[model samples]
Target: MIKHTPKQQELQNLQQHLLTTLHRLCPVSNGAAPPPPGEWPTTRQLAESNDITIYQARNLLLNLAGRGKVLVTPGPVNKSLRWYPSL
Candidate 1:
């Protein structure tokens, strides 16, 4: 069997909490198709869903992406971006 250090276990727990929070904060819409699992949300979408200002959402998403907890995709229009949790 494999073993995990305390820190690794804690990290895993934190990731799980984050995932749960993300889902609760941004549930898939009724009768609307959902993205594949682990796919990130667009910056605009995230902002609207979380009810935060676009600037704050962008910064949060970028920080999550940098930590490897989330992935980011450039928006089709202009240079905006989207974010998803890393699978």
Candidate 2:
């Protein structure tokens, strides 16, 4: 069996919650809204829409991407990344 630290457990819980929220906000669908016309939204946009801090938004997006719930692409400006819900 495997072991999990308290911090790890908390992180897992947060990831689950973020996944649930994302699904509720943007249900997965092939015909759903395309990511913007060109590029995806920056971390700031995701945080603003989700009402979370930038750090939280980044973590949430990364988690979602890891779980295949969202697609992440390189941003056009700066070295920041963009996020789009996977359909």
Candidate 3:
């Protein structure tokens, strides 16, 4: 079995929580068809789901995206970000 440091474990927990939140927010999961690329939960909404601050949620999102567990794309308008679950 693999072992994890306390920080690593904590980060893993955060990643799982974020993924669950994204799944819950997915359009298809809401009894709708799949959404366009820009349809995703806002950073604020995600933060609220996880009970974390926006800045902290942003950092966690970036970290997850870097690891390919999540996907980050440009919004429909500005260069702002849109977050999605990659799993």
Candidate 4:
């Protein structure tokens, strides 16, 4: 089983909340699906939108990507990432 720290749990909660918010805020043709791959927001944008540190945002997304909750892709440059919800 996976044990998460208190802070990690908090972030996980935030990530779920973010998904709900994103689902509402993100423009999608299909009401039930996440945005297209091209429309996936950058990690920086996700952090800025949620007022969280990039480290926190990236780690959360990384965890999700690992678990197949989201689709992650490398950005055009180093130290950058893009993600779209798969949940």
Evaluate all candidate structures by whole-model CA lDDT and list the values in order.
0.60, 0.68, 0.77, 0.72
Instruction: List runs of model 1 lying over 4 Å from the truth.
Output: 1-40, 74-79
Candidates 2 and 4 compared by TM-score, better number? 4
**What TM-score should be assigned to candidate 2?**
0.58
Q: lDDT by residue for model 2 over 1-87, one digit each (tens)?
A: 789999988777766665566555545566756645245557776567656788987886787788887777754445667666677
TM-score top scorer? 3
Tens digit of per-residue lDDT, candidate 4, span 1-87: 999999888877988865665555554565566545566777788888888888888888788778887778755334567677665
- Top-scoring candidate (lDDT): 3
Question: For model 2, where is the 10-residue window of minimal lDDT?
Answer: 32-41
Structural similarity to truth (TM-score) of each candidate: 0.50, 0.58, 0.73, 0.66
* Candidate 2 runs further than 4 Å off: 30-52, 76-82, 85-87
Q: Could you arrange the candidates by TM-score from highest to lowest?
A: 3, 4, 2, 1
Error of 1 at 50 (Å): 1.0
Which is the winner by lDDT between candidate 2 and candidate 4? Answer: 4
True-structure lDDT of candidate 3: 0.77
lDDT of 1 by residue, 14-68 (tens): 4454445566655657656556434545566666765667786666666676788
| Candidate 3: stretches off by over 4 Å | 27-34, 75-80
State the TM-score for model 3: 0.73
Candidate 2, position 31, lDDT: 77
- 1 or 3, greater by TM-score: 3
